[model samples]
Target: MVADNLKRLKDEIAETASRFNRNPDEINLLAVTKLADVDMIRRAYDSGHRDFGENYVQKIIPKMKILPADINWHFIGHIQKNKINKIIGKFALIHSVDSQHIAEAMEFRASNNDIVQDILIEVDSSGEIQKNGIPIDESNELVHFITENCPHLNLLGLMTVAPFTDDRKVIASCFEKVRNLRDGLEIDGLKLPHLSMGMTNDWKIAIE
Candidate 1:
């Protein structure tokens, strides 16, 4: 069942990419593997899903060992400074880089290992106080600051989780905003290529 689901998701993404005149390969799928078992993850890998996202450290490490070296692991959860060492070389991308303190800690840790880590800045697109991210007004400055200060960490792009709204127009508007921000920053010689937005429910709107 997991394999079938993965395959269907891949096909759907491919089709959606085609609709946008994008190459299917350009749309990388990061399977959200939180709470999933090794067998399920293996099934996803076997089905050609190379990127896997995990929200929990403990649940992710075991699967990391079992999966093939080619598989890309992405950390999508809030990271503790003490636990920074454990995930240094493990993730291909870290999508939850929200603060200067965490960014500095990750930078210092990566420098010791001589490994450059790719990361995306997460913003509170929903505008909720409970979420952890740089404010929308301050996001660009934060990105610029990280690029200048954190030599070990590469700022790949911006990522946001929009509020849950059933309206398709609202969802599309949110994703457009992310794209616009990325585009505007790119104009200033900042090469932020990835705009990580959308989820299972509103990915179609995101793609549009």
Candidate 2:
């Protein structure tokens, strides 16, 4: 089942990327293994999907212990400062990095552990009050601070969750804004190369 899903997902991703003249490899497929069991995740691994996203530490740790070390883990949910210690040497990317406090905790943990973790700055592009990310206006300042304070944390990219809407234009505009932000920051030597905005629901539109 997992292998079939992976193959289908890969085909869908390839088609979407092609529509935008993008290399299929340019778009990454992170298997969101939040509620999936170890067997399911390992099945995904067997099918050549190396990247996995987990939301909770409790669910992820046991799976991590069972899975191979080569698997790339991405934390895609709200991360607490108190939870930082447990995840210090575990994850490869923390996607919900919103505040300075969490940033500091990650910095201290990564620095002390001698682990250089890659991170994506989560931006609240849609102004969702319930979301956990820095506002678009303060993104630059937060990025600057991360660069200065966390030498062990590499700011690999930025991520945003677009609100669910029937309008395709709104979705396109959101992704365009993220792309523009990345480009604008690059002019100032901030080379943020990754933009993780799309999900299973509208990933087709996102690739375009």
Candidate 3:
């Protein structure tokens, strides 16, 4: 069942990216494995799905231990300060970096661990107060802070979560906001190549 769903999802992602004239390889379909047991996750893995997103630190720690070492585990949850030390060198990429303080903490942890942590600055582009992200207005400052001061943190791109709405225009606006923010933030020596947005409800619109 999971494999079938995974194939359909990948096909849809490919189709959508192709429609936008985007190389489907440029769009990674991160299998959100939250609430999934190791066996369930392994089923997706066995089906050739490797990149996975998890919302909690505790849940992913053990799974990482048992899973294939090459699996790209993404930290897609709101990060807590207390666990900054816990995930220093663990994740392949972090998509929920919501503030300057959090980025600083991650930098400290990464420097101490002797590893550079790659992350995306999460922006509240949709203006959803209940969601976790840096407000779009102040995201540029956070991006600059990481680039100028945090030697251990690699600011690869930006991330945002669009509200779960049937209105395709609204979802597309949120994704566009984040992409524009990323473009505006880039300078001569820096380039943010990734934009992590969209989910099951609005994935098609996101790629388009």
- Models 1 onward score TM values of 0.93, 0.96, 0.96
Off by over 4 Å in 3: 187-189
The CA lDDT at 54 in model 2 is 88
Name the lDDT of candidate 2: 0.86
The TM-score, computed over Cα atoms with residue i paired to residue i, of candidate 1 is: 0.93
Better of 1 and 2 by TM-score: 2
Which prediction has more favorable lDDT, 1 or 2? 2
In model 2, the runs with Cα more than 4 Å from the true position are none
User: Residue 93 deviation, candidate 2, in Å?
Assistant: 1.4
Give the alpha-carbon lDDT of every model: 0.84, 0.86, 0.88
> lDDT at 29 for candidate 1?
75
For model 2, the run of ten residues with the poorest summed lDDT: 124-133
The residue-by-residue lDDT of candidate 2 on 1-208, one tens digit each, is 8899889889988987887899998888888998798998988898888999988998899898889889999999888778898777688887878888888989988989998988999988877788668888898988999998889889988998887887888888888887788888899998887888888777887788
The sequence of per-residue lDDT tens digits that candidate 1 reaches over residues 122-207 is 98765778777777788888888899999999999988887787988777776777788889899999999888887889887777
